[model samples]
Target: MRPNIVLFGDSITEQSFRYGGWGASLADAYSRKADVLVRGYGGYNTRWALFLLHHLFPLDSKKPPVATTIFFGANDAALLGRTSERQHVPIEEYKENLGKIVNHLKECSPTMLIVLITPPPIDEEGRMEYARATYGEKAMTSPERTNEVAGVYARGCVELARELDLRSINLWSKMQETDGWQKKYLSDGLHLTPEGNAVVFREVARVFCEAWLSAAEMPYDFPHHSEIDGKNPEKAFQQKCL
Candidate 1:
């Protein structure tokens, strides 16, 4: 059976299978060589995610994923006692939760490769302004999530990855390296635009190539359909496939 590459995260991950998304890109790249599973829970924080992990993952996995990307923090970074407080988790707790996740995955499958993904930077001004436009000033309860706060969580993510000796992708920092990255990368201030997805796809592909799969060395399951002899399909498949 093909190995699995799991995508576990929040809204961004939930939408990752959409057109021009990172999940789709991975699936396309792996094709017949592996399976890509997207397990993104929208509006969920680390605390909630921890509860769900038990159900989705076997403690003693008979089939561990070849790789899994844990992308969260966007919802967890929500301001305390604010509009998004329901999803808010303290930075300390967020850090601990991340560690717990890593440990749990490791315990289940020691050899499973894990990638911790920091949430992509949010467009604070753009998000706030959009909220005001939709809900009006009075209806706008709070600046639930801000770029400044997200930066803190992002840092924590990277630092924790180092401490645990796991691979990581700091989308928060990477997205900011470019000018007007907010406008190009973020769609609704939090979710990724197509351009943002492309950015992520490139990074994921890089990791897969550098660490997991060697593109040039790996072969497809069978010969290309075009190469099959139309007059003798089964014979062609038998000879070429083997």
Candidate 2:
């Protein structure tokens, strides 16, 4: 079977299969080399995601994914007392939950490549506008997330990655490096725009290529069509095994 890469996260990941999304870009990039699977859950935080580890990456599974991305914290960073407080997970617990997730995946396969992605910066104005547009009179007066608080979560995610010696993308920092990122990268203060997705895809592809999963180096699951003789097409596939 072709090796698979799993994108495990929250709504950003759940919507990653959408047109022009980062996950879809990865799928296209790794086409014919490895399968890219999405395991995203909308509105989920690390605390809630902890419950899914056992089922998503069964420890006893013989064919564990070769690589997996753990991208949470956006929802976890939701401000307390706000409309999204229900999704808030204390900072310390968020880190702990992430640690648990990484440990679980490690137990499943010590060599599996694990990449952690920090929450992106939040745009209060954009969030407020989105809330108002979506909820009207029910919208909260203040944004449910703030860039400052999201930065705290982002820092925690990076520090945790360092402590665990795993790869990570500091998206919060990266996106902000570019001026006007609020509108350029984010569509709803939190979620990514097409440009934002491009940034993710570029970073992820670079990391995967550096970590020995370069599409150029990976072998296709089936022989190239050029190898098949029209007169005896079966010959080309005779020795191939799934």
Candidate 3:
């Protein structure tokens, strides 16, 4: 039987409009060993996710998923400097919210793996320019002026996860390593494009597959497809369609 994975994140993960999200790609990549559940919402932060977790995740006797991979930080990192209740959650609150999520998930399913993902870095000029074109200069100014402010919050997530002993994927650094990663993977300087979704899916897949193999104490052998031993460019491209 295939293991089940729940993708819990923000706009980047929910952006199916840009060509579907990584969850779809993951479904295809792990067709033989796992299934994916996409529970992403745009403009949502970790705090909101924690608030909605009870409704979104019911880890009762219904055979809860085997793992939950969390990808947040985009919306949380948005420092619009607005007074609106939703504009942003204070950094301290953000930490508390994550703590709640980690503690809750650990108790609900002691055996289920929980993976936290750092937010990807945004292209300052590019995103701001796009925002200006879409929402006018007023909205773009904040994004343009700030440099790596959100990245700080993303880094905080890494620290928070480590303190809590949660498994985490450093998306911030990963995105930086890829050539033109932002341009190719991002639909808007802030949201992920189809290509970007593929990148995320591949990384998640590799980690998941490796974890599964490790737990089973067996070597991974794709005799028919020697190209994918937890890494391959074609696999990322192929996952885009799923």
Give the number of the best model, judged by TM-score: 2
Cα lDDT, model 3, residue 220: 27
* Clash pairs (backbone) in predicted model 2: none
Regions of model 3 farther than 4 Å from truth: 16-20, 80-85, 136-139, 144-147, 213-242
Instruction: Report the number of backbone clashes for model 3.
Output: 1
TM-score of each: 0.92, 0.96, 0.78
Tens-digit lDDT track of model 2 for 1-242: 78889999999999998878999999999999899999999999999999999999999999999999999999999989998999999999999999999999999999999999999899999999998999999988999999999999999999999999999999999999999999999999899999999999999998888887788888878899889899998888986653
Which candidate, 1 or 2, has the higher lDDT? 2
Model 2 gets an lDDT of 0.94
Q: Report every candidate's CA lDDT.
A: 0.87, 0.94, 0.69
Winning candidate number (lDDT): 2
lDDT of 1 by residue, 1-242 (tens): 77888999999999998978989988888887888998999999999999988777888678888888999999999988778888999999999999999998998798888889998898987688778877886655556788989999999999999999988899999999999998899886888889999999888778767776644556777877887889878876787565
Error of 3 at 78 (Å): 1.3
Write one digit per residue (lDDT tens) for candidate 3, span 1-242. Answer: 45677888787767643455677776665555566777888778877788787776665646667888888776776665542236476667777787787777776688888888878878777776787788774563445313276677777888998998777777777787888876876656766777777767767766766666232343222323545446565674464333
Ranking by lDDT: 2, 1, 3
The TM-score measured for candidate 1 stands at 0.92
Q: RMSD, each candidate, Å? A: 1.9, 1.4, 8.5
